[model samples]
Each structure stands twice: as C-alpha cells, then as structure tokens.
Target: MFLLPVLLLLSSCQETIESKDWDTIEMPRVSVHDPSITSVTEDGEEVFYIFGSHLAQAKSKDLVNWEVPFQTEYEDLDNNIILGDIDKNLREAFEWAGKDDADSAGGYSIWAPDVIWNPNYKWKNGDKGAYMYYYSATSTWRRSNIGFAVSKTIEGPYTYQDTVVYSGFTQVDSTDGSDRNTHYKNTHLKKLISTGVIDEFSSNWVLNSGTEYNTDYAPNAIDPTLFYDENEKLWMVYGSWSGGMYILPIDEKTGIPMYPGVDSENQGLIVDRYFGTKLIGGYHQSGEGPYIVYDKETQSYYLFVTYGQLHSSGGYNMRLFKSDNPDGPYVDMKNQVPVFSSTDQNSQYGVKIMGNYQFSNMNKAYKSSGHNSAIITEDGQWMLVYHTRFTGGESHEVRVHPMMMNRNGWPTTLPFEYVNNEYFVSEVGDKDIIGSYEFINHGTTNDPKVLPLSTVELRADKTITGDVSGTWDKEAQSSFISFVIEDVHYEGIIVMQQDETKEQTKKIVFSAIGDNNQTIWGVKK
Candidate 1:
C-alpha cells in the first residue's frame, strides 16, 4: 500500500541519509516559545537540543522527532504560589544585585534563554561545564534578572548558578557621565504600587534616565544570547523593548561581565562598565529577542532580532544586521545603513528572514516566527531554529529552516520548514523555471492558523497563470526571481528542497516578500 513507502520515507528522514518530505514532518517540541538550539554529540551520534521560554527543553537525534527531558513552568519558580502570593523572585534577584526591597517592579515570566559550552568556565570546586543563561521578568516591564544554571555535561539537570545581572540600572548618559539612581527605593514603590503611580516611569525614554522602568538603559537584559567569536572572545548580547539591544564582553572564567565595575560615567557595573554597544533599536520600541551568529565564511556577524510584538496577532517577525566586527557598527546589506536608524524605515532594513507565512494548503503555515537561534551542525550545515504559532493554532511550536546565502551575500531562508531533508543550491536556468507551482501568500491576519495554498503557473513568456494572475521574471544581473502580483514586485532566491506533499521529491522553492510587507512562498508542484 502507499502507506508503507510513506512510512518508510518518514522513518528514513529521521534515521538515515534519505531526503525528507516536509508534509510528513511532525516538528518536535517541548513547550515552545522562543526556541534556541545547540548541536552536540552523544555516544557518537548527533543531537539537536532545544531550549525555549517557560524553561522548556527538548532534544532530538534527527531534528524531526523531539523528546522533552525537563521544563520549568512559571509556577515552579514563584515563591508566591507556595506562600499565598509573596514576591520572592524579585527579592532574591535584588539581593544578589546588592539592592533591597525587590518587590517594587512587577512582571513575572521567563523569556528567551541561551545555552552554550564554556570551555574555560571554572566552578568554585574548579570543574568546568556547560551553562544556560536565562531571565525572569515582571509583566510590568520594570524588574528582570539574567541568571544562569550549569551542568557538568551538555545534557543535564543544570543546577542554578547565580544571577549574572539584575536589571533596572539608570541609563548611562555618556554626555554627563553621572550616576542616576534609576532603581527606586523598594519601600516607596511598594507603597505606591496600587496608586497607578508607576505610570510616571518611562519605558522608552532614550535620552533621559528615570526610575525603574523609565531608565534609559540600553541593555534591557531579558533575551540573552552568549556567542563567542572566532578569536574565542566571549560576548553577551541581551535586550528587549525597554531601552534597546546591547552587547557586552564576558569574563571567560567567571561567566559574568568581563569588566564588573562601574565606569567613569558613574553607571554601575551592569550598565556602563560592562555594556558593550547599542547594536539596534529606536523604532516602534518593539525590538526584542536578541540572537547573534558569526559567519566566518562571510567574515560577518549577523545580529538577529524580532521587530514587533511577540504575539501571534502582534505582527511579530525577524530582522538582522551584519558587521565585520563582533562588537559592532552593524549595518544592513542595502545601502550600508544602520539597521536601526531614525531616518530610514527601520523595518525596511535587514533581510526579513521569516514571518507569518503559509505553504501548500490550510494544513501548512506558521505565524509569529521570531525569537530564533542559529546553529551550525556538526556536519557544517547552517540552520535557523525558531518557534511559530501556526494558523488556527494558539500554541507555539518550534520549526527549523535551512539558511542560504543569496547572490548578494545576504542570507535568505528556504520557503519550506526543515524536515531533516537534503537540500541543494538551486541551479535551474530560466527555461527550467517556468512551470506549475503552489504559491502560498502569508496574508495579513490576526487569526493564528494555516491558509490554503493557491496554484500559480509560471510561463516561459514571463506571464503567470492558474490561481492568481501575476507576471514572473528574474533579475537579469542577479538571476534572482522577481514577480509582480497585484502590481507589487518581489525578489527572491530559489533553492531545491523537499516538497511538503511528496516523499523523496525535490522541487524548486521560491521565498520572497512584497513591498507591501507580505511574504510569498512557492513550491514547484
């Protein structure tokens, strides 16, 4: 029966070197939001281990099927849950940061976490191990703690280490170099907690410093990504919608800020002394989810971040900037402009890698595809792993996509979600490109679920047929596909990857986004 071969192919996709069909993929997950992956070997076999928000952790030998070993839910860390509503989380963090009354600022949730191997990290007993740097923040956007837990081995029940940074530092005004007490007296804030007096705190006051949430601190230490450069220098990039994104050098030995002392600017050890640079921000103040990957082949460091609200209906998406230097003056590929510029349209910069998109039929789609992590497999393949909320689905699920470089040296994602399939650089010429294909438009929608794929016919005469009428052509110089639908032009690169519906079938997939900010994904039928 047809079921036998289909089952065989699916098994091969997970267990062997055979090609995988995207349609047959059941993406692995634990509790998915902001999935970050790292590859390591266990017993001479490769494993793609995933970690995400809510302290969810999962691992897979083959990428398609996942098994969760542990998870830390919100209630697990809340002292109030056991004590009938007492704010113990912030108190412990503030105590570590040498402050009192941590109960003032009020948000409670764990966000994106970064797990990495610290080769030179030393424990008190002098044993080194892998570490997971994560955060806990109050919903009011006032208090946060970037803490870490370590494990003797890569796969582990990591023991809590310490709070690396307790947030709420007064912004560093380089102009004055003066200390501003951004942290409010805990006693005062607690008394005024019910009076809506916290509204006076500025969340995006970039120029001036204010108390608690209003501080102009550039490094909003929520989503932490620790990446080491080719030179083996460890760096930490963390931030979200408060001040902006920042990068800081890390002490290889202690796994803390390299220079853990206040600078001449009077900013504290966490804010000024260790703060590296403001990589990007200042748009709608929606910038969050900081992820950085250094591509040695291109001699560039790609800084990826989400630009909108991190919710299914909140227009969540991904954008990236590249820099030759690790701590950088990061710029976009186009015009060599700052990725986060006040003059330019901010969202217009950085390659829009993935967003709310659909492919095939109503069964296949993804939305709010941001808060990602990148990994280079042991076999030297590149992948962008993230979590997405599918159409008609309210839950977040992790998805992986192979990242490819276009003719311009910038990276673009293949149209399909990765399914442990073998993909190759597309070499089809103009003559071979004209054919019948399935086109999926990531139509703007608040409904979280998949939409049906439509049919499109690419004609040799540069005209389109079938479902929706459009003109298709390729750029003469770059050979990138450019097509017009509804008078909008989109440019894209093609790659040969597995078609979602057919097992062992390879097809040309085109992924592009229109000027109207709509993304289109097409798979050759």
Candidate 2:
C-alpha cells in the first residue's frame, strides 16, 4: 500500500497532480547498449503498450510512468500455460536465447521496429492484423535488411517475418554527389538487367558521411517510419549514411517502399526515389525520428525529424517541417523550429518551468533526447514524448510530458515538478450552462501498461473513492463529455467520446480543458 500527503480541496494545484502509488511500476533499464524504442501501441482508449529493445513495456491511462510484463507471465511464480500457451512458449524462447550463444547473437540486432494495427483485425480469422516492421543488422552492423513481425496484439510475443527491401547500399561515403563510379555504377548495371535504360540510379550525397561499422555506408540509416495520408497513399521517410534523407512511395499492397532494398537493380528507384532533387534546396540531413501527424482539426501535415548525431556535440536535436503533401519536400514553418531544446526558457504554464537552464551553451543533459513523438490531446492540445536525463548517466530513457503550444504553433514542455504540485477542479455546474464540478480529490493509476497514468498505480477495482465534488454533462445525441469541477473558478472541461468496443465497459482519456475561458486548451488526463 502507498500513502501520500493529502493535498486537500486545493484550487491551485491544477498543474501538479500527484498520487504516490504510481511508484509501483519500475522504470525500464537504460543503457548505451543496443536497446531502443521503435514503436508503441495504445488502446486509443487508455493503455499504451510499447514495443522496443528486448521486452515490451506497458503503461497506464495517462501515458506517463511504465510497467513491464503487462500480462501475467507464464514463468512467474504462480503462472501456468493456461491462457494460450503463448506465454509458455515465450519462456522457452527466452531460456533458449540464454543458453544458446549462436541463437542469442546471430540475427540483426533487432533495429528500428514499427507497429501498425489493421482495422480489419479478427482474432478467429488469424488476420490479427497487428504488424511490425524492423530491420536486422549483421554482427558487423553492415548489410542490414528490413524485416517484419506480426502478432495478434501490439504488445506481443511477435513472430518474425522475412526481409522487406534489401538495398545493398552497405558501402559508406559512396555518394560524392557527383561520383559516377561506386555503388551507383553497380546500381545502374543491375538496373540495366531489370528495367533497361528507362531509369538509371539517380542520387546525391549528404556531406560524405561515414559509419562505425567501417563499411562507409551511413550507419545512421534505417528506421523507416510510415504514415498514410488522407488519400490513403502510403509515404515512408527513412535514411542512413552515404546518402542523406530520402522519401519514396511505398507499395501499399506489400508495404515495400521504393528503395533499392539492398538489392533492387531497379534504376528507377535510384532516380525516382532519390531525395536530393526532392528536397526544397536540400534542407534535411542526418534526419531521424520521423513521425507523420495530420491534424484532423486543421487538415495539416507535420513531419518531425531529429537532427545531428545522437551523442556528438555537432548534432543532437528535434526540428519539424510541414508539407502540403505527405510525399515531401517538407518546409520548416518556424525557422526549422527547435522543438526539443536543451536550454531553459520561460515556463509553458505561468509557473517557472526549468531547473538547470542553459541554451546557447547547450549541455547534453540526456545526450540524445530529441528523437521524439507528439500526440494531440483529446481536447486538441499536444503532448510531446522525449526522454530526460537519468541520474545514472543513461541517455535514451524517455518520458512523456505535457507541452503548452504558443500562438505561432510551437510547444514548450511543462516541467516535472509543476505537475507534482498543481491541482485541477472538477465540478458539477458552471456559468457555461453546465453542472457544478469541484476539484476532484487526487487519484492514482489502474491500467497496467507503459507510460503510467495518474502518476500512481491504485487498486484495480477501486472506484475513484477520493471524489471531492465534481459534476459531469453530456447530450444524448452528441459525442462529448464535460466535467465541471470547483478547484478553479473556471470549468475544468474534458471532451471525450466513448469508444465503441466489443466489451461494453467504458474508459475515459483526459482530452482538453475549456482552458482560457474556453478559448484555449488545458491538460485533462
């Protein structure tokens, strides 16, 4: 059991909501080793199940703190192979990996994973439509090939699929932006055998990059993130070394993009898929962390990219560009706005935001924290996902924090301490023709998944026992839920639509508050 200081019917603790129980979930181990987070899947209802390095991590309703082994493991003290026998099989696999050196070290060190849920997923049909795409690298980290995995659920004991496109672009520094000799020559010769002279390998270089693998190809390449446009055409943005950032169309049917795939002699790929001519005056370089976000509210396109080498001082950042088309030439609207800065600035919320602040002399608190992702809140606000520094010097350990967007449409992070101290009011009636809502007493997490919710885990069957006077409203015909609480004079508005699930149970995600007297948005869940 956990205990906490009771922050009574406080009206001012809105930004700081704390429940001690969340400490139950352990933090994922961080290291400079080959671990990474490629993708995460949430119910779109509440829980977020993240797929990464070795094991899958789960989180709570708020997507903050995280937990592992979301489901009861078969190898645990009290378990049995009673469910689907999957847990048991996974245990065997783990033991085999432990004992079998050859089995443990051979495959591509599982790099750049991505997961997608098929709308048509059906448990019985076996088309559980949850798919993942990741690349596997040889021990030398050269000749890496994209591979696929599939599972019935996002947090899976996934079954690995085969290679995607094997572009043998292994040699590094091959692009002089003018060299006709190296890989491109071999590439064109192969193209001659496939599509004839209709197309030749066409491409350029990004400042002659090199890799740790000594293969000369950009080791930074790979990690192909995908997104679909309103038109449903698939767009994939991925890059490594030798060549710079590249964007090409993916064969939607097969999920294969237009890369040479380490082998395709298709000269057209080299030509039609080259990124240099595609970029508007060559703006993107050493790009990583590509996420495509379409604002349904505004119908806009955003492509987020990470700049600089992860640990190198010359690079280390997050920059975004927008485009009218999913197949970019993306443009930086706010002067290539730096979304994740190492320096401190004015607080996002009125309260002071940072602790150790320094910019122009940017220090690497968490050397490479900018390969980030953002989520639009239910209320239309945006949440940024980036890791902060660990006390023990682990760099990539990530955390999700709420961000406040400026008028120019950029965001500043809400500090960890602020959320530790604020209180939000939930009432039943308000002047906006609603019910009175009071500052509902603090609560804790219930869902067991990655990115803990409520900042604390609570009794699973608990029914919000700490209610401090709150009211709710909804019209039978519409899709909105409103909470009017009394902690603050204004209504702490929350707008959520009940999800249509096979199970009739209801779940709530904090969306947006009718912040700014109903003009701007505020944090909810």
- Regions more than 4 Å wrong, model 1: 1-30, 70-91, 94-108, 137-139, 169-219, 259-274, 336-346, 424-430, 438-457, 461-492, 502-505, 512-520
Model 2, position 61: C-alpha lDDT score: 50
The TM-scores, one per candidate, come to 0.72, 0.50
lDDT of all the models against the reference?
0.59, 0.35
Error of 2 at 461 (Å): 53
Best by TM-score: 1
Q: For model 2, how does the per-residue alpha-carbon lDDT over 13-58 read when each residue is reduced to its tens digit?
A: 1222121122224443322111233333355554444443232234
Q: In candidate 2, how many Å is residue 219 off? A: 8.6
